[model samples]
Target: MEPASETPTALLLIDIQKGFEHPTHWGTSRSTPSLETNVASLLSAARSYNESASQPILIIHVHHHSTSPSSLLHPSARLPGTETSAIEAADFAAPTGTEPVLTKNVNSSFIGTDLEARLRGFGAGQLVVAGLTTDHCVSTTVRMAANLHVLGDAPDGEGIFMVKDATATYSKGGFDAETVHAVHLASLDGEFAQVVSTDDILGRVFR
Candidate 1:
């Protein structure tokens, strides 16, 4: 994956939380059965690449926290396996000290967080985005990332590469999850970002 420039790149993981994994609470019908596995593999490769590369990759996690007490994702609500809005253990490995987790309440990770500033601070002009609900948080954040102008005059000129297989969405309103996932990817492809697979990311971008 050739970057737009030599600027540092970051792997932005969005809303890969346990709250979305609770079958009974969140319902079934996912875009891919191997979504978590693919995400974990990508995360591992990104971390490894950061360690060995001359320009380290910044790994940032965007976590969602609902404020309403009745919401399933409310921080106080407990899932079957975890007590908080923690990253899903089944699909994601534990994060290290170097990685920072940014919390947000809305769909876009950039809305209430310093993510844009942080990316600029790290000198990251390219973003590798992956996460849950391909049609929701993933799509919103990517669009914002592509349009973000940290320097004030023009858009930050960031290049966003989305991992297709590493993201999943739930079936909704009689539509299948797979179709929803594909439609969203199609909409984003060649527009907000380039949609690619985990294998493509590992082989081309991570190296």
Candidate 2:
């Protein structure tokens, strides 16, 4: 989907999966309550602004699921009927039909998914990303969004906006949540996209 407006914006909810509940990925390092609470807040904010026809709030949810044998989160790794494979219950409770969920395997939401098409269809130019593990899928997707012009040969412009408070990261590659979150946000803000909080963004949507 293309940006609906001259400066159209949308929100991308990335990888708020139930698999993170396991002590291995999120529980041990990132913690569930921290990630879940922030995401819930962002969802509520996005939903409220979207209600008004004047304010175009497009919400696209991105879920991560892997089928690769080498994948760290293969289905076999998870217990049957766990929230890991399905969309979290909280997400379903979002204002009905407002959020459409997209499942992906690669870190970048644009990879092997119709995300670009959906964004273009919705006419969304700027994207706000919020969800689990800021250093991995969220970080990768932001980088891709910022650099998409490379493929299309368009002039440089603000491509993505990340909600800092709404994002969470795990301890990975020798970096803990504090270090990873800070470094990634610094690189993303200005360079890749604007970084804002759920409250600040909520104000814009409502006002």
**Who wins the TM-score comparison?**
1
At residue 51, give the lDDT of candidate 1: 70
> Candidate 1, residues 70-169: lDDT per residue as tens digits?
7666777677665554334334645677789898888899999999889888877567888877988999888787777532333433367888888888
Candidate 2: which stretches are off by over 4 Å? 1-7, 31-34, 69-72, 76-98, 150-159
lDDT of 2 by residue, 1-207 (tens): 133233567778887765555565453476234556667776776566556646476778877777775443554554345445433433432435646878788899899888888777766656777876688898888888777742233333365667788787767777776777888888878877778776666655323
Per-model TM values vs. the true structure = 0.88, 0.78
Alpha carbon lDDT at 124, candidate 1: 71
For residue 106, give model 1's deviation from the true position in Å: 0.6
Q: Runs in model 1 with CA error above 4 Å?
A: 3-7, 81-91, 149-158
- Lowest lDDT sum, 10 consecutive residues, model 1, at 149-158
Scored by lDDT, model 2 comes in at 0.66
Could you give the C-alpha RMSD of every candidate to the true structure, in order shown? Answer: 2.9, 4.1
Q: For candidate 2, what is the TM-score?
A: 0.78
